[model samples]
Target: MFPIWIHTKEEVKRLLILGAGGFGHMIQETARLLGYEEVVFLDDAVKGADVIGKCCDYKAFLNEYDTAVAALGDSGMRLYWTEKLMEAGYQVPAIIHPSAVVSPSAVIGNGSFIMQSAIVNTNTVVEHGVLVNSGAVVDHDSRVGCGAHIGLGSVVKANCVIPSRKKVEEGEVIFSTRRKIDGVTSRNLEDALYAFGFGLQCSYVKPFGEGHINETYAVYMPTEEGDEFAYILQRVNNNVFKDPAGVMENIFGVTEYLRNVIREEGGDPDRETLSCIKTKNGCTYFEDNEGQPWRCYNYISNSVCYQLVEDPEQFYQSGNSFGHFLKQLGNYPASSLKETIPDFHNTVKRFENLEKALKRDIKNRAITCRPEIAFALDRKQDCKVLVEQQENGTLPLRVTHNDTKLNNILFDAETGKGLCIIDLDTIMPGLAANDFGDSIRFGAATAEEDERDLDKMHFDISLYELYVKGYLEATKDVLTPEEVESLPWGARLMTFECGIRFLTDYLEGDTYFKTAYPEHNLVRARTQFRLVDEMEQQFAKMQEIVREYA
Candidate 1:
């Protein structure tokens, strides 16, 4: 449990961590693992949210503390506690969980908390009070402004700067934006805006917790005192639309539906909260300045919420609710399941791609795979990990959770019952096994996945049991026996699936998973491959356990 948080608290000359969420706990444990042994967790919460893992607190503990990690799940929540701790003058330590694999050359500042599995690569400079959260990777040479909370599992590739107190959240990637101004690329507006006024406070409290993205800002047509409220600055990137047009389109559609639904259900149509203001087509969604794609969606104050939810956990449930909502749109008949790739299990394609890429000298292949360069397998294994599954008719295509982890499941904050899943961008026609297996891998591991003492870390069968019970409880009626039977295999298969990905990356010269060290991806592959071996050894027993649960 996050009892480790006791260590981050400032009241004690040592540390006192507060939360027990896996990310929080990892930070606590990481401090100890990284040689900060005086750490203690002050984990006393009103509910089970306080008892993530083994941590439990009887009576509510007081903040006779200063300088907390502010490692709470929500970026907004982190800011809340951080303000409290700072007001009390408790020195919030800038902690990179010992296992985060930060580049030695990287500079981390005070009050920063780098949670588990984060990868901060070479020359990346992090200012004070940054939150480099779980599974989030800041690629080579990135800069994070003060109090920027990088969210769970998000990817920030290459070079970029996250502004002060901004929260760049889960599952998104950021890259620098440069528009060729007069053939001389001008400074990007979004980047310039984010870098504006270092004292800006952006994160605001939300019903479910705190809002994640700080991609916009609210301002008037020039105030006497420059007074303003919080706003989100839409992220501008090459792969993703900088002008939030695509984003606005889909969101507008969803919210419009929500509004109509509320009105038809006899709810206050006047209560409809959001106002779509047209500011120079590009000002809000599509505009061309700097020749760079820049767009934004400023929050209209005190309108109506498009979606309704009770708490933070409910916020994540939007993913599942979206699924059901999609089903309701029966106007479009559900298409048959089909893999994007034929015989989707085919790993052989990996080799083909790798071979061809090398032949074509794609990007960094030459530098990463040069005979002069050094890495195991000479970086050829990236594509070599694929398999050639026999043609087996067309495989069914169904929406899937490409990245499955516990927090990804939107649980009822009150009941702790998982209501829906979130972060569906990677959804594709894939096997249920992927999601089911990943859920197990994420939660059941004894030591954090990034843990150094490999021996102390392994899958926790009890957690695995709980995951299966809960997962099956929700999905059993619709899942087939074969699918259920394959649950154990699912874990191993997913491990191999990831091992292949890691290995594939290894062959590709470590381009996919950001590495903090020379052999970071290799180490990741070893960890996953070892887990796969462990899964294989216990395959029969695991299957039996699944059978019992089923």
Candidate 2:
């Protein structure tokens, strides 16, 4: 027999609720209001007035009660009980409150609950075991999948498909027409998409980019002809970035400024810089239910990001791109930018952090890599080179991208030139040398950051010369002579600083950087130290290359 809708007590004599908890009690009260003469609960724990037997013994009372409701808080449990009771020849009817405004045209499946003042609009299909809670709205033509719970006051907008067993949180506006993508949908990601107002029919949503600091997703929304990547959503790593709001502020400010500058220079502002997509309430970032900060930006259509430098031209383009970026933002008030990460590029402070980590030896790992530790300790004075120069006014502070690795620069797919410098999370007031140094530290490397063999990782001076040529060619007119000369030191100290950071994270149990293995950070430290050693040996040649370009 098909499941029925319980509108009045005349249609059902006695109502049996499976759970005897608060929700079960609520269902009992609602059933009574609908004119059910008797309401009894079968619970394993609660034993009181009107309680009949344990939940597992429902089959024994099959003849006594003709109508039943799960009344369980968990959707899975509710569905399981509802199906089990239906198979036992019981009428599992939908128990909707009288105040709810459910359209006659809407299909309310059996075993669902339309609670107080809830509105299920026309043509909406609320599947079995669903709960449209108090003041919730399943707008026109939307489908609330089986066993889904529409939380109190949440709004499921028109034509949206809420997947099965998904819980729409209280007050959340579900704007997307969701289709299940493998390894894509989460409560946090869904809320983040809703917050950013991306509610069109989603083709797919998948994790994008190789950034270690933030969780990034590429959201594709269907258009007239086909599916297109519409936006880039990122969950900012609050652990690494202590002040997310401050970070967003810096990003917003810098990007807005870049937009204006790009427009003035007859450049496509959208392609040249990232355009931050504000939340529905116009906030720069949306804090999810878990207090994690999420932000979205328009996806640059014809751009590509590289994880490693494949060719000499790519490295040159990376240098040119970053150089041009610095030149473009040269006039902006650098001091106004918030230090999203305080002492981010402070080599001295980084070295101190390593010292602390070594002393603590939280993981008792210092014994495994004595050579790495000693390498860092011997170059203690090297860490202070850039910091001292900056403090004494020899190096001027500029708006620096703290992480200027080759991958951070997005190249144009058509031209194979650097299109945009993405990943602006670390934009802060810092020295020009640090920025120059960071790019050199990564782009001009002979091997991967985590290369195990020390012999394989050498400082590629030829690649370094190409980058220096590209960088100085772009910014020779804008940068100070002091900044130009400090570029070599930037390369050296930055490499050394990176080694120090890896060692620190290693000693502290590899908490900072993501590691594939227990000794991964140590391997990375060794690679950096190898590069630093080569850079130090070729220090004169590196300086000459900078001077040659300058």
Candidate 1 lDDT trough over 10 residues, lowest sum: 1-10
Model 2: ten consecutive residues of lowest lDDT: 1-10
Cα lDDT of model 1 by residue, 1-550, tens digit: 0011212323234465656666667676766765654555544452343232222321233344333555565555555565555555566667766557688778776657877788998988877657888789998767887668888899887667787778786788887633222211223443434343211222221122222222223432234565344333333342323334444543444445545754665654333323333343234443435543433334433322212233333323332333333332222222332222233333345435545545555445345534322232343343222121113422222344445655544444444434433332233345555567766665565554445566865765656666666566555665567667756766766665555555556556665555566655545655665576677677777888778867
Over all chains combined, what TM-score does candidate 1 have?
Answer: 0.42
lDDT of 2 by residue, 206-316 (tens): 889876678999999888979898899999889898898999999999999999998998999999999998998989999988888999999999788877789899999
In model 1, the Cα lDDT at residue 430 comes to 50
- TM-scores of all candidate predictions against the true structure: 0.42, 0.71
The per-model lDDT (C-alpha) reads 0.51, 0.88
